[model samples]
Target: MSLGAAPAPGVLEERYARLPAHQREKLNRIADTRRRLDAAARGAYEALREAQDDLRRARAALREAEEHTTRRTGGTLSLRQPDGRVMEFPARPWPPPELAQRVQRLEADVARLHAEHAAASAPAGVTTRLYERLLEHLGLRDLA
Candidate 1:
């Protein structure tokens, strides 16, 4: 029963068999809950990573656009009229305002994803701790 000692073969199975039906059911329920929490946490973590990648791409695009705009003249296209008259058509910046707006939106999305990741991670951690404690309480810490 000591921490350094290993249980004999089939000991775990024997102990589990000796558990009361209600207690076994409760353990199963806790295990199922832990699995669900872990799944949710993984999903949230993936989403967070994806959001961060999207934010990075958005930022890079915005930086490139800004750089292009700064290195170029005002957005204007000129054409020579049929009568030899020069006409200029005014236009927006090289990178439209929408790109900047997209950057802003992506930043917000990254923040939201971070929050969601933390929310999901916290529950998974708590569940793991709870399960560990349950195993210890059942004298099955080795199973952890």
Candidate 2:
């Protein structure tokens, strides 16, 4: 059957009805297994997406905090030279204690998010591997 265009509405049903009873039963079992595997894959993908969103949020928060700190402390410095000339320099101060602590917390949050993302991705990888093995066993390795 061509995949580019779907079969007519009842074509699948008619084909299945023409099959022998034993083959129909086996096809039903395979369909059920495929449904379960698809659900598992979708769940794993959702988990990975959530983890990625969390990581993005944490990184955004860290960037905002750092920008705020920089804005507050990144001022210009000026000095009067002994020859009555004025010299100007940029003054970018180190992060204040509070800002430092906040940064440290955000860094930890990012690390945790990274770990969560990895954990969530592992299940999806395992599902793909299992599905590939199943296809190979069924002599459908081309599908894999």
Candidate 3:
């Protein structure tokens, strides 16, 4: 059996095509910006994950180094961290400088990427709402 005819163009596409060129341009710009923001959010999320993994490795290394230091010193290693958690690192010998720095850097990177991802993803939703409102205002809500 043959289907009678091809379906008509999408109602939304037809309605969108009827919009004035300037209005179409505006919508396209908003769409492009939303795409860019979404891409950035994804990139930032991946970066954050990598940074967190690096931080985890750095922390483990630091712990091992501290344990060794404690063993060598023949004393307990305990220090209160800025977050109020007591980190047991031989009080006598500090963490290897490079390991401590790497951990700090990774922590900062994770925090920054978290903020960036939030910022980038947030505007995508805002643009979507604005696009819907524009469509509604233009009497295209039903088509949308």
Candidate 4:
């Protein structure tokens, strides 16, 4: 660890090398952590997408319902939720209970995506493929 001597070959690579008895162990641990996170991110992203799709479909259905009601009732669509909140649609942004709940969930998911995307910047471009490769090298790819 002296500073006066010239650095040896593979010095930089050796810096990441594990101890004699712990060869590849630290790297293995890091890869495992990254893999877990990658799996969690994939799950979260999938859930977000599903929730978003659900929200879209719900909103579209509500719109059609409102249009149909307005046309039939002359701009008066009475929708009674299970909680007994009967309100006239085409008047406020909040239409159906399902749409409202899904929108809220979607908004939360967007916030999570923003946070995770910000926190997930890998200098080596840790993409899904890269993540899988790392797992493969660690002999844990099959678990993923």
Candidate 5:
């Protein structure tokens, strides 16, 4: 739309065009807020990824320590961890209910937040269905 031409019926674009000093300042503030929100969300997601990587490293360390203890001691891997807590590997593999529950909750939270972020980042007039489809691949749904 041209600056001189009238915008859609109740858009207030005409007024926005006229009040350069006031409206321009307001628009600038809005734009700055939007930019900051985007940056903050991006930072949050990056931090989350880093934390996930760290968690993976910790799990890898635990597994490696178990294997090393098993091979070196020629006995079942039962020893005190760095925190002075003894850990015993189960002989038969079994699902840990507590761990499973925590994992499920975290996955759900991540999915919800991801969906919300994607939706928020989308431009005005974008369809919610389209936004949701984008979230589907991330195993997410729109959230508050």
Candidate 6:
């Protein structure tokens, strides 16, 4: 067990297992927190992908609905607002506000999750390498 040499496989884990119970518990908690955070980041990415897909589907449906409405209404579309106002468009009618807002909300959600996911993902192995360096500097690597 040199001061800074890499421990053989299982040697480090053996040493870790020999640590005091409280210290082992703390290390386990730290590892668990990392796993949970990683899982949450993955979930956010999945949700972001789902939101993007929903936005695309919503836009496509809106286009299709608009075309259908135009054909059925002879280029005039009338929509009733929540405030009890009837609004009519003559040609290439605008989408109902609710429908438009649904797409907007999904787009916004995707954007937010994308930013969060990017922020959550640190460069891989950086923290692990840093911890290894710290342990070596402290001469703790000899514990193996």
Model number with the top TM-score = 1
Predict model 3's lDDT versus the native: 0.74
Candidate 3 backbone collisions, by pair:
none
Which of the predicted structures, 3 or 4, would earn the higher TM-score when compared with the native?
A: 3
Task: Return model 1's CA RMSD, one decimal.
Answer: 6.1
Q: Model 2 lDDT vs. the true structure?
A: 0.57
The CA lDDT of each predicted structure is: 0.77, 0.57, 0.74, 0.57, 0.50, 0.67
What 10-residue stretch in candidate 1 is worst by lDDT?
64-73
> Positional deviation of 34 in candidate 6, in angstroms?
0.8
TM-score of every candidate: 0.78, 0.44, 0.71, 0.46, 0.40, 0.58
| Best-fitting candidate, scored by lDDT | 1
Global CA lDDT computed for model 4: 0.57
Q: Model 5 over residues 56-137: C-alpha lDDT tens digits? A: 6655655654543422233334646666676666342222355445555555656666665665556322433443443343
For model 6, state the Cα shift of residue 79 in Å. Answer: 16
Q: Which sequence of candidate numbers ranks them by TM-score, best first?
A: 1, 3, 6, 4, 2, 5
Model 6: ten consecutive residues of lowest lDDT = 123-132
Better of 1 and 2 by TM-score: 1
Error of 3 at 31 (Å): 0.9
Across 14-124, the per-residue lDDT of candidate 6 in tens digits comes to 777777787667556545555666776788788888888999999998887665542327776665555667677675536778889999998898899898777666522
Off by over 4 Å in 3: 1-9, 68-70, 74-92, 142-144
Q: The CA-based lDDT of model 1 is what?
A: 0.77
CA lDDT of 29 in candidate 5?
58
Q: How much is the lDDT of residue 142 in candidate 2?
A: 42
User: What are the C-alpha RMSDs, in order, of all predicted structures?
Assistant: 6.1, 9.2, 8.9, 11.8, 12.6, 8.3
Residue pairs with backbone overlap in model 4: none
Q: Would you give me the overall lDDT of model 5?
A: 0.50
